[model samples]
Target chain A: MNNALADKALWDLRPGEAATVTGFGDALSVSYQGRVMEFGFQPGTRVQCLLNPGFGAPRVYGISNSVFSLDKEIAAAVFVTTRPPQEASS
Target chain B: MRRVLLLGSPNSGKSSLFNRLTGLSQRVANYPGITVDVASGPMVNLPDTELVDFPGTYSLEPISGEEAIAVSFLNEALADDHVSHVLCVADATRLEKCLHFILQVIRECQHHQKPVTILANMSDVIRDNQLQFDPAGLAAALGVPVISVSAKESQGFEPLVECPAEGAAPATPPSRNWRETPNEILRGTAQQLAAQFSPKGDVLINSQLRLDRFFLSTALGGLAFFFIMFLFFQSIFTWSAPVMDAVEALVSGLGEAVVPLIPNRVIADFVADALFGGVGAFLVFVPQIFVLTLVIGIMEDSGYLARAALICHRPLRVFGLTGKSFIPLLSGVACAIPAIYAARSVDSPRQRMMTYLAIPLMPCSARLPVYALLIATFISNDTILFGLVGWQGLALFFIYFFGMLVALLVTGLVSKASKNKHSEQPFVLELPPYRLPTAKPLLRNAWNRCRQFVTQAGKIILAVTMVVWVLGYFPNGGADLGESWLGTLGQFVEPVFAPLGLDWRYGIAILTSFLAREVFVGTLGTIFGIEGSEENMLPLVDHIQASGLPLGSGIALLVFFAVALQCVSTVVILAREGSTRLALSMLLSYLVGAYLLSLIAFQIVSLLF
Candidate 1:
């Protein structure tokens, strides 16, 4: 995880755990996987963990009315500050 | 002429509004990736106005190839003064999320001095939920006309059409750095706006979350996906069979009744053999085409296809295709022409090219008639294994499976050889909330697709059938086909297929079939003096069975058609969509591969039998 995320990776987020995006880690940088940014993954976004495929694979996250599934490696690159479970209204 | 550009995020009901405004039955699906190309038609009520529907995109920044297309089109429209207005469509149910794109549209319009309007689509959802949409507040904030309309229910469109033609430029340009805008800021602003409009926030999200808990679950979702696919393919066979039978019987009955009416013997033979035997053979597959399109349309409109793609992505990635490739590949089973067009949704050019290479190998509807005829002719219907599975059904399933396997193998090989394999895009797709599909659009789209397939393929099929009929009817005037001009041509190619234990007649059929795979059955029927209809299929089967062709050769023919790129329309689509080089290379490689593999299968089976 990026140092800016306080060592938090998005893949570690559980369902109903809301988080505020800090910045893209090395993998999701424009020089690397630019699509991560294109998919509305910019900083200060609120994302709630929706579902995990349950095989140590990708997990689905709901952010700004869009549901996106990201693999473990790419999910790990999305650094965020975890919001308390109570903050997730849905 | 007034040109109005309609823009929206995917699945925002943008297409429905276009359909309503233009009175055109444009394809409206529940998923995000349906409209890859722009569809344009004149507005129904406004004769001087034209509406263009663009592919949905999340942002102006280009991530995928389709998004790039959308972004460039918007840029072009902004620069061009002839475009009178830009209409940004937003989903009323998901207003908070949709505002992100709408804001970008407003900013871009401001910079270009183009007038913009916000079309609040899906107002019926708001009405059903008893929620409010404050068009006045939204209008004040955006400094543009905000129109709330239900494109599906056909309400609130009058305000849209009655709006003035002269687009007033914004008095003050809104200055916001789109690239640097924080997602939290946009989400918060959108939420505040939504709250201002509706007293309750998150009403839609809560409903969606309750459903997603089960639909997005790991095991249940996977099981449901497979079950749906199995039911879909099986229904294509079972549901379409009766309709197919009816069509076949009608064609044969017509041929029998009409052939004797012609006074000239040669013309009579031509009418029966060429027109009825040739073109009629291809018409039987139309029912299957309708069934395939209808099923796919429902799956798309119900929002299940996106989930299926999500599940298949992991498996498809292993084969060098993205989960996005699934829709197009499945569509290929119905027809390769539209499948090639659908492939434009794939983000990566390399993967798209690989997909094109695999599409022709799909056991399309064109191959179904040939497969049925061959399987019925060679394999006994009573040859049941385990007393539960009929040999015929099993053979059909195996052929489809075989084609899919070859498609995957070819895609994998091409990916391995591709130069940009290292820099592949990450798999990212948006899953929309589930909605019940309407029957009106489903049947209409299905009918439109069936019509498209027939009209596009009809000309080529007819011309080829006529030419084959002429060659066979000439040089001897209804004498033995063995001494006819077609026989001379068939003899020339006989040695090529002789290794497969086929005679000159079969060679002639194979040659004619190059125009379209279904023509194989028609040419064979004509050569054997039978109309290519369902009633005559059994007689053709009997003739082939008694003709002394080895069992191995029959299986060889089946295997060959299953693997080959035999359809001219498929090749034409490949050339048009991708490149002539790609199409030519695919044709050459598959032709060689089909011949060699069939040869090996024939030789081994001959030895065993």
Candidate 2:
């Protein structure tokens, strides 16, 4: 864990690196096996980029947050996330 | 309903993406304390999935209005249970700068563990680029399936609609944190991007500019604004004249045709003086007003207007306002009604109120007739220059110049009077590539705005004109109006204006304008007792000139109209928006402004001419 943190601090934020999760939440907690693939279009999935759709647009939910119907259709798609830059493993 | 949230960086075609996603379903409003509009709409992507587009921003920790709305909307939706999916839209042309917003959203989603999709808009722009960045490679790096599409051409839409998008995880889906992965290293992103894709491409996605760009943008914006304004005003006359003339002819024809049909002289005269003379004359100006609104709408839609606000930032900041005040002020030049409503975009309540307080100082369309009449009548064709340029040209120029100046002065004075805190802000503008205003939306808007003006004139201008006509029409003991009590009333008031060098007929015209300035023409037309012709308009000018009304009076009248709080509709708007106190203050301030400016203008012109 300490090595991962040091490496995380050392290596430039790149496409592929392995480190233990810290500050876990429903936002980026997608089920993954090979470098974390996403199961998108599910009801309980929480999205960070879409919280409040302004005016009349639909709102997206982060996991644990209830799903909103901006429209009626429901399908899950995949998105990938990486550790935030400048943070180190402990 | 399934929700689709659109995200992007400033000027990265976010708004255009929204326009594409939402089309005519778009509506604009503000998140609290933000000047940028947070617009949303549903996309019929899948059978039941909805699309919700958010405001464009630089980072999630939104500072300005656009960013605030973006950040706030996301944060708010995360706390709520409504939204299903998030779509991170990035501009392919400026892909790197857009990454910060994407990364920030990623962080937030990590914090919440929600899966989001990235829609790389302007894919068409990238498709045509000399340097191509691998979308699949970038998508692999982020771990989310990245969909490349151009909204304009509807490319990649079927894939987008057919592709899976869901907020909740499927049963037994990978829910591990992103940090456990090997690709999660965080160093050298920009340098790698530069080495890998930038030279052949242009990547500095996460960057800002020196202050000089803002100033340059402002200067260019000001020049462009004036040039566009000139075109706008030119179009108002050139395009709307035919329609205005036709309406005038039709109304006059109706009044004349009805005169012989209706036997009673009073009824016939009332029909002529009140309905046709008053309403018809005011409605004649509607074409010009409608054409002006269309130009404004086009300017706004094409996105050059945002640059004007950005360029106007420092000047606007001087008045304790945001650049947001610029559009409202411009809107006031057309009419204060929508202009005041436009004030809702201001983040600070104080700034919004200040805008409302000051917008009326900008001369509106109601004052246009007064200005046109004065300029056409009193301005000489002769060119007198200070060195080599014409003084009259300078004078005509100063008419618009002074109106804006008076607005600034009012803003300053009102800012001083109010105890509101004003923080200085820089203008963040997105200059959308200019496009021709399309026919359907443009014409629909023009017609809607034009219809309102005609209707209002039908209601108010006609009523007031009729009242003024009746007051001037039937003299005491049924004596001749131009010769009896009405003439006597006009004469009594005539001397009061003599100080400014106007005759009683001018006095009568001014009195009629208490209803509306446009009514001044119809009032004079009726009081001159001329019928079925615009021919007498020239004679009325002749009579004013022939009456020995000094150049000073003409100048004074113009100045007063320029500064005066003569617009009743504006007053009503102020009262409704703020309070009676604000309304009264507006009235008092304009009255003072008009008197002082007129006094100065009349004195100067009297000495010169």
Best DockQ among the predictions, by candidate number = 1
* Best by the TM-score measure: 1
Off by over 4 Å in 2: A1-90, B1-10, B22-84, B100-116, B130-145, B159-200, B203-232, B243-368, B371-401, B412-422, B427-508, B511-515, B531-536, B542-554, B568-587, B599-609
**Candidate 2 per-residue C-alpha lDDT over B1-609 given as tens digits, one digit per residue, 9 for 90 to 100:** 666567665455555556566554554444455444455565654546556656555555544444445577678775555666667887655443455456557657666655667777767756655446566666666666567778666676565554435554222222334533222322124223322432242222111112113322334534656887678656655677898788888988988888778888788777877777666766666666676667767776665555455455556766767666877787787667667656655645567777886787677767766666666678865665545666555666788788888788777877767643223332223334344455555665566656644554346555566666677777552245556555677888887777676677777777667656665665566666655214445666665566576778888998888777776656665665456698788788777768777877788988997
Instruction: Give the per-residue lDDT of model 2 (tens digit) for A2-32.
Output: 2222222111122123222222223222221
Q: Give the alpha carbon lDDT tens digit for every residue of B2-29 in model 1.
A: 7888999888888778878888735432
